[model samples]
Structures are given as C-alpha cells and as structure tokens.
Target: MGISRKKIYEEIADLIMQDIKDGVLNPGDQLPSITRMAEHYQVSSASIREALNTLSVMDVIEVKHGQGSYIKERMPLGFEHEFQIITRKDIENLLDLRKIIEVGCVELACSHADEEDLGRMQDALGKMRTAVMNNELGEQADYEFHMAIAQSTGNQMLVDLLGDVSEKMLETMKETRRIWLYEEKKSIQKIFDEHQAIYRAIAEKDSGNATGAMMRHLEEVATVLLKQHK
Candidate 1:
C-alpha cells in the first residue's frame, strides 16, 4: 500500500524529536523555516507544519508569534503516552464544543467588551499578522485572541471554564490551525483575516456578525481537518 500522509508526518515529527534528543537541535534553538525544512526533507510544507504542530503540542517546541519555532526551554517530562492518547476524534469533538463555547463568547464580547478588551484583542491580532508576515506560526497569539474574547464577557465563570481547558484547547488549536493553514493550502494571511473579521465585529458591537464570524473560523478549521482525516 502507498504510504499514508499521517504516517509520513508522524515520522517527520519523530525525526525532529530524535534530533532534539541527540543534541542536534538544542533547547532554545530556533528551527529552520517550514519552507527550508520542506526543501531539506523533500516533503510538502503541510507535512512540515504537521510535524511542528505535533512538537509544539508535545512541549518539545514553542511557536512564538513573529518569530520561528524554538526548542522548549525545558522539554516535557512525560508526553509520549499522553500524545498517543489524543486521537483525531478527540480533536473533532473538542472543535464541536469550541464552536459552541467560543461563538457564544464572541457574542457576549460584542455586547460588553470595553476599550481595554478590544485593545487586547487587537494586540493579539497584530502579533498574528506579524507572524504571518515573517512566515511564522502564530499559535500563541491565536490562543490569546480567543481568551481575550472570553475575558471580555465579564463573566468569571466563563473565563475560568475556558482556563480549565486551556491545556487541551491549546493542543487542539495548534492542530486545527496547522491543518487549516497548511493542509488545506490556506494562506496565513487568511487566518489573520478571519480573526480580524471577528475582532472588527466585536469592536463595532455587532453581536450577530461577531458570532457568525467566529463560527465560520472555527467551522472552517474543523471541516478541513476532518476532511483530511477521512
């Protein structure tokens, strides 16, 4: 049988992980750009992004907005077992729930967000735009953007609820975002544009538009990711 794309990416992730272990890629070292890595590995940019996504989620790397991927300051002590347990089904379920929760969050933000809240969202989006311009992944800024919206609700319970799931949600975000950005062949600019649209709606206090934009962003990521899994 032909090699599956999933297996190919997993192997690429493993190779990078091994490089870390062998001191070839030391802690805090910035990795080559996805384009360069793809050229070296003779793989597609999507595969490189998948490998980086897995590493980021595993705590083996940190993807900083406006900068490239870096080896973590401290590697995860025990991530292999946990990583193995997270199936595509788990991500799909989480995306379904994220759509429900975050769309509501954005609607509330549109209704109640203050200037400070809008400023925070705008800051996150700015970082995301810079990351895109530099050909970097804006995973952390993406999380902050959504969290800022949740905080704008002025509902502590909702904020706490999302904070409780922050770890898993982070991993889910990295996966879904990479799939949408690279696997779906969507541009990084598109990701920033989608978030910008949501921010604009909230800034204008348009609850209907805010929720609709948020839903579309989440659903597009989910749709592309699930389609790849199939």
Candidate 2:
C-alpha cells in the first residue's frame, strides 16, 4: 500500500505553523516575500502562495497589498486546525479570477496611471527582455511587470487580488515558457508586441483600446497554458 502525503503547499503551510509555534515569526511581523519563501522551501512560488492563501483564508495571517504577508496581530481561533490542501481546480479558479480582474485593471490604469507608473512598466519590460535574451526563466521580471499594470489601476484591492493570481499561474507559466522558448525555439517577440500594444494604449489613455489589448493578450496566454496542461 502506498502512503498518501500532504500536498506541497499543505506541507509548506505546516512549516509556517511550526515557525509560529516556535516564536520564529512574531506577531505583526511581515513574512518573507513569496519568491523568498519559494527559495527557502525549494518549491515553486505557486506552492508558497497557496500556503499563504490557506493561512489568509483562515484569518491566521494577513496578505496586505504592496507589503508582504504578515502574521496577524491576534491569532484567529482554531489556528491549530489543519488546512485543506489546495488542488488544481483551485489554481484554475484563481487564474480565471485574474482574467476577469486584470482586464478591468488595465481599463482603470488607462485613466489613472501617471508618467512615472508608465515609465516603471517600460523599465520592467526591458528587464524581461534581458532575462529572456539570456535564456533565463524571467518569471520574476514577468510577474513584476504584470503586477505593475495592476498597481497602475490605483485600486489596492485589485492589486492584491492579482498578486495572488500571479502565483497560481507560476507553474503553468513555466511550462508554457519552456515550450515557447526552448522546445519550439520560438522568439518571444510576440510577448513584447502584445505588451507594447497594451502599454501604448495605457500611455495614450485609451481605455477602450487598453482593455481590448489586455483581453486579447490574456486570452491567448490562457489558451496556450491550457493547451500545455492538456
């Protein structure tokens, strides 16, 4: 008989719980960023995010926009209980939420993003191009650039929501990125093209055009990710 183990994220969550019990992470202290947690755990950011999400849902920790996750000042009741493992379906739903929220984010960004925000988006894109050219995963740069767009909306809630969505897509993004950059040996120029279109629309303050570009870009990416999983 085979022994069934906890999901990776569940295991990660339990480790956090242990840290809590050991007084390693004190109340009101911010946890490490998701990327750092992933590195520490030798796991994907998706797993770390899922673990954090479980804690957040349980009211044990707080996920604040812009700032990292934090230990709640007051521990929620039943903090000793086990967390339900996040499954593939949960990730899919998170992605779906991203699609819905980000399209709206781009629209709001068109009207709200200032010169500095747009410039930062451009800078992030440059970093992404550099990462891709060097044959690196570029996942960090990619996530940053996308998060910049969400931040541009000036809606903290939307920014926070998309931040969670970014992690859920991490694994799928890696697979599709490999297929696009290595297996097929295709230029990721299309990615730049789509991002450029979206950026230009936002810079021009063309809400309608920005929304359309974002929709098309995300829809195509979603299709590619789904195909890879299939």
Q: Which candidate ranks first by lDDT, i.e. highest?
A: 1
lDDT of predicted model 2? 0.71
Error of 2 at 221 (Å): 1.7
Computed on alpha carbons, the lDDT of every model, listed in order, comes to 0.78, 0.71
Candidate 1: 10-residue stretch with minimal lDDT:
76-85
Per residue, candidate 2 scores C-alpha lDDT tens digits across 46-94 of: 8889888767654568999998899987653223223323344554675
Model 1 root-mean-square deviation = 7.8
- Candidate 1 whole-model C-alpha lDDT, 0 to 1: 0.78
The residue-by-residue lDDT of candidate 1 on 1-230, one tens digit each, is 12356566777887787787677877789999989988888888898898888677546789998899998876543222232435667767778778878998998998899999999999999999988887666888999999999999999988888887788677666655655444446777888999999999999999999999998888887776566455
Clashing pairs in model 2, backbone N/Cα/C closer than 3 A: none
Q: What is the TM-score of each candidate against the true structure?
A: 0.65, 0.58
Per-candidate clash tally: 0, 0
